[model samples]
Target: MGTSGDLPDGFGPTIGTLGEDPLVAGVIERYPSAPWLTVGPGDDAAVLDLSGSRAGALIACTDTIVEGQDFRRDWSTARDIGIKVAAQNFADVAAMGGRPHTLLVSLTTPADVPASWAHELADGLAAECSRAGAVVAGGDVSAGTEIVIVGTALGSLATPSAVLRSGARPGDVVAVTPGSGRSAAGWALLRAGLVSSAFEGLLSEHRAPVPPYPAGVEAALAGATAMIDTSDGLVRDALRIATASSAVLGSSVVLDLDPGALAASDDLLRAASALGVDAAAAAEWVLTGGEDHCLLACFPSPAVVPAAFRVIGSVLAGDSGVGVRLGGKPFDGEGGFRHWS
Candidate 1:
């Protein structure tokens, strides 16, 4: 059976890897825009220019993180959670081939939680925003039983182009920049009581998913027609892009992965195995699990596949509906994390 791939390090976020998280494809489809708008939610952020020219126009996006649902106070620290909240949102901005410019954060927390958490959160936001070449423009605070973080990002394409998910076509080689699965492994460790520094290092990844923004921009420049992040399992996520772009994606093909990532993954799996958890099954946590915030993308030509990426599959024309195909047939295993099931 065809197995979903671990996203490589460089390509931008894509539905091919992440499946559907935050907002599904239908949501973006609902909000079509005019030319003057420039970019829309379907890409990274929304761009609008009072000026007719697309050059030097402004682009922006808004994303949120909720407690109990998006994150757990027990698992993540105030600072890490804060940074993670901002980092992933900002990654979305980069995914659209937009440069991150500014961020606005809104926080909610229980009365008993430490107030220092907010400051720590701000620090993390500042660090990540600065790293992304963006600034913390503004923010707000409120109260609630669980923690919630809302971030808004502002950016610029400098020229006015939004990298979309439905651009993949037949003959296009599918490749990913980097691999994503560490977070799922780390999360599995935490769930398995292996919360030691030796094992839970992936917790850092889970808290703050490092999406290769530059890689995404590079992909766009390198004829990456379609892009997405691995927020869901590979099969499920790639299918979304295939269905949208009318192409087929397979994970059984040769795909490159970071040695460090592979090593880290092996360790996590070993620990999970000792805990009676399926390390291979745990691999699917990120493969199929949502919230890793990794990027997945499609390249128009094999030349566009960078050294960091591997040719995981190809976009085929014929019928719509993406799936895990191995040996020219549908490969099914772990479906994906279902909501409310």
Candidate 2:
């Protein structure tokens, strides 16, 4: 029943009553009113003003992370979890060619979870929102058996129409932001118990990925034909755009990727060697890794591709259903993470 100011530094015996808990109060206190948020936390529902945008359309996306399924407390801190969830949601809005505007967060945790942990999680979420040019309007917290965090991001389009997965064309060029395979390599290192400082950067990325928040808007402005967030692996997500575009365009689409364009970086190669794996394994991580949250987009031509994006492949007419090919051969390697598999 103590105020947020009176909360102790370490984990308490259990979370207190919801009505008088410091965790909720602390989280509410952390967010202030913004120009876009007419009503913030401490209210039943947040009121956002979108009239300022030239394009009145709204973009919304939601993503969830569970305790054991999406993350582990031993490997990632509350702040890390917050950053990861926020980044993923923001990336979704960006992929749609929108500017991230506000976020609604919902958190459920076991009674054993400390108030400090919850507060830290709020800080992490707020920090990421600031980085993405957005705000945390409001959210809910409840008691549960395990930690569950969900983020619903609402954004405003910068262009007349939001870019979609079905907008790709046969002659479009495929491109991606700078990061790929870093998160997967980080996961590999963590799973193998290879916590050496040499792999700290990779481990950090796995814990909390830093997505290219601005590149989405940039691509849209530069006339990107289609775009997607690389939450799944490169090939899997690229295939998503191909499939969607194919259905709309009435022709099978194939994304022909150049292997040299996606070669493993030096850091990835080092991690591969340390794990007793070869460069091929490292390359697989880039191809099949997920959670990096980078932007994958198709432009009308290589000349129109934004500088922030690197040309990696091209769209082509396919003889069969939509698929991805590497070096002109159909890729058969495993896809990214999937539930119930």
Best by lDDT: 2
Per-residue lDDT for 6-102 in model 2, tens only?
Answer: 6656634446543335677888787655876877888789988777643468889999999998899989888998999899999999999898878
Error of 2 at 208 (Å): 1.1
Q: Which stretches of candidate 2 lie above 4 Å from their native place?
A: 1-9, 17-21, 53-55
Best by TM-score: 2
Tell me the whole-model lDDT of each prediction, alpha carbons only: 0.61, 0.88
Worst 10 residues of 1 by lDDT: 251-260
* Candidate 2, RMSD to the unseen true structure: 2.8
Residue-level lDDT tens digits of model 1 in 186-280: 66666666677776557777777776767666766676777776666555666666666642333212222222232325665676676686655
Tell me which residue pairs clash in candidate 2.
Answer: none
Going through the candidates in the order shown, the clash numbers are 30, 0
